[model samples]
Target: MALRFAILGAARIAKPALIDPLSENPDASLVAIGASTRERALEYAMTHAIPNAGTYEEVIARDDVDVVYIALPPAGHCEWSLKALEAGKHVFLEKPATVNEAEARVLVDAAKKAGKRLIEAFHYRWHPLFRRAVEIVQSGQLGELVSAEAEFSVPIVRNAREFRWQASQGGGALADLGCYPVSWLRQLTGAEPEVTSAHQDLEPDGIDRRTTAHFSFPNGLQADVICDMDPEGGRKPPRLELVGTKGRLDIDNPLAPQYGAELKLTLDGQETRETFPRRPTFAYQFDGIVDAIQSGQPVWTEGADLIANAAAMAAIRRVAATG
Candidate 1:
């Protein structure tokens, strides 16, 4: 039987985030889609060739839906995910899972109570490029990890109607872009971070356009992240650099290896460069989701890690709230 999904919200991000990947995953199917209005839902389903379209609640209540893909903005993620799980369907949630950690906790607990599987859609994590990076860190090739830095920057979306410009909608450079680096750092170290300082540039309505924050881990590892989507910031590809007692590693475009990624390691006066398959990261993720559901294996971005990541992001916001 195919793993079926019912998506909430006619979100544009869902197309590349899932639909394209779903096209390649034979074990899974995008059976339905829901939007603010039935008309909009029907239009999106028609364009995508998905069979069912309706209001969000209507889709969740469908007996044939095996999973709920919460494709709404960050603000609605927790609420809808909880409802979906409560209805006995698994949940595939978008990033920045909630407005804050407290919200994520509620959603997490609800899933536990419902005895349903839940996963945060950190699509890049399943890619071999990222997997190799994590392995290098764990293999002690970098030796007694010292410090790390991650940066993701893109041109500011100038559209007045863009949801990311609205603070209430949880739109910001940090939430949309920075979360990747935060999750990356936390996952690599398996340690929660202490936000030492944070700074952000905001739009007119107080939405953050650019943010940079420093963090320190329990193991004495120091890390910093910068996510910029402001007018002054130009397109900067995703990159990560790590230094250790013995050597250091640098990764270019870890965000999406298929778009082209390069990894360089320098150890004891010698350096080496490596690359991975250019498969779409989403295909790995979409198929991984289906496998996790059918085989009941654990996924990388599930359980307490979701709340831990939320806590880290929330901590950064608390500190950034100061200046």
Candidate 2:
């Protein structure tokens, strides 16, 4: 039986994150959509070829939906995800899973108690480029990792960026973009790191336009992460850099490697470049989601992993406030 997906909101992210993947995943089907209003849902439904459209509550209660893809704003994520879990539907939530760690804990607990597969959709990690990096690092090919750095930045003008992202509303460089580097470091390191020091650049409204933090992992691998949303700061390639005892690895645009990233590995003074097909990151991610549901396994971004990422983000803010 195909797993039917019902979108929880008419969010802009719904297309690349869920709908497009639904169209490609054989085991998944787009059955319905529930937005803040029926008209909005209906409009989105018509645009996406989804069959049913209605209010949020009505869609969750439908027998046709076995899964709920939540594309709501950060504030609404926790509430709606919990509701979906309580309604006996698996949840695929967007990143920063919740506005804070407290809500993440609650929502994760609810998913566990409900015995449903809850995934925090960190789409970048699912891409082959990132997966290959993980393999190299884990294969001992990286050879006793020494340190690493990952950065994601976009140069949207302040006015354009601030309109939707206020710190109070869970909008900031760190919350919105920093989570990726943090999670990437954690994934590659295979252990949680301590936030040794942190800094933030804020707007008049207290939005963190840029945040930089240093972390020290238990295995003696130190790392740095920078998330910048400053327009004047110019653009940055979505990159991750790793240094090990034997050699170094530099990835250009690792975040969306499908779009193209040059993955270079240098060992013993021999350098080689690796490549993966330019399929969208969501393609691999959606299939993993379906496999998790069918096999009764947790997605990579499920359970403790979700809570850990949320807690790490909170720690970054706390450290920045005190530092």
Candidate 3:
């Protein structure tokens, strides 16, 4: 049976990244949508051909909705996700599952108590390109992984009133965009590198406009990430690199908005290149979530790791505060 999904929010990013893929995935279906704004919700439902539309609470309360995708603002995520779990629905929550670690713990507990699946929507982790990269690194093919570097940034929408510039709504370069590369770094490294140093440029609204972080692991694996919400209006790409004992790999567009990244390998003292082919990242995430829900399995971006990411994010915020 196709997974019956009810989206809790009509997020602007959802159309390009999520809804499109869910529509394409064989195992997933976009069944309904609940928007806080009824007019918008009804319009979205009409345009998308979703079967139902209602308030978020009402959507989860329906027996037909088997799964809930909570794409609300970061501050609203934990509350709605927990509510959905309590309603006996699996939840695919937006990233930064909570504004802080304590909230993440509570949500995880709720999922445990309810016997439901709760997954953070870190879509990049499910991309086949990254999967292949992780396999290569962990297979000893890259010889011993020594270090990695990544960066994700883009100019913010040229409007001061954009939600991303708001503080109370969990708007910031770090939360909205930084988490992308950070999650990728953590996945590629296969360890929670100790966040040794961090820095970020703050907007007057008390949100980060740009930030950079550095982390090191006990195994001598080190990583650095840079994020920016404001950029000059031009095309810029995210950069990914890994250096190992025997060879090195570099991937451009690792967190691409439209396509998968290119994976390049330099080994045998020869430079060879390969393209992983472009596929929407959300498609893979949809596949993973469906497989997990069908097989009674955990999503690859496990809850424990998401909790750790929240802790790391909290620590980074503190470092920024002090500096």
Native-to-model Cα distance after best TM-score fit, residue 52 in candidate 2, in Å: 1.4
* Model 2 worst lDDT window (10 residues): 156-165
Q: Residues 1-323, candidate 3: write the lDDT tens digits.
A: 98888899888766755688787777778778999877878988898888888888788899988889888889899889888998999998888788888998888889889998988988878876778888888787778778888878888775665777888888898888888777887777777777788998887778898888887876787888788888656446888888989999898887753554578988988887677656777777888888998999877665798788888788788877786
Question: For each candidate, what TM-score against the reference?
Answer: 0.97, 0.96, 0.94
lDDT, candidate 2, equals 0.87
- lDDT (CA) for every model shown? 0.89, 0.87, 0.82
Shift of residue 85 alpha carbon in model 3, Å: 0.7
After superposition, which runs of candidate 3 have C-alpha atoms over 4 Å from their true positions?
232-235, 257-260
lDDT by residue (tens digit), candidate 1, 1-323: 89988889898878987899888888888889999899999999999999999999899999999989888988888778888998999999988788889998898888889989889999889999888888999898888888999998887567866777778888899999999999989878878999999998877888888999999988888999999886354688899999999999999998899999999999998999999999988889888999999899999888899999989888888899975
Question: In lDDT terms, how accurate is model 1?
Answer: 0.89
Candidate 2 RMSD to the real structure: 1.6
Candidate 3 Cα lDDT to native = 0.82
TM-score top scorer: 1
lDDT string, candidate 2, 242-317, tens digits: 9999988999987788777889999999999998889988888888888889889766798899989988888888
Query: Higher TM-score: candidate 2 or 3?
Result: 2
Off by over 4 Å in 2: 157-164, 231-233
Q: Is candidate 2 or candidate 3 better by lDDT?
A: 2
What residue runs in model 1 are displaced by over 4 Å at the alpha carbon? 231-233
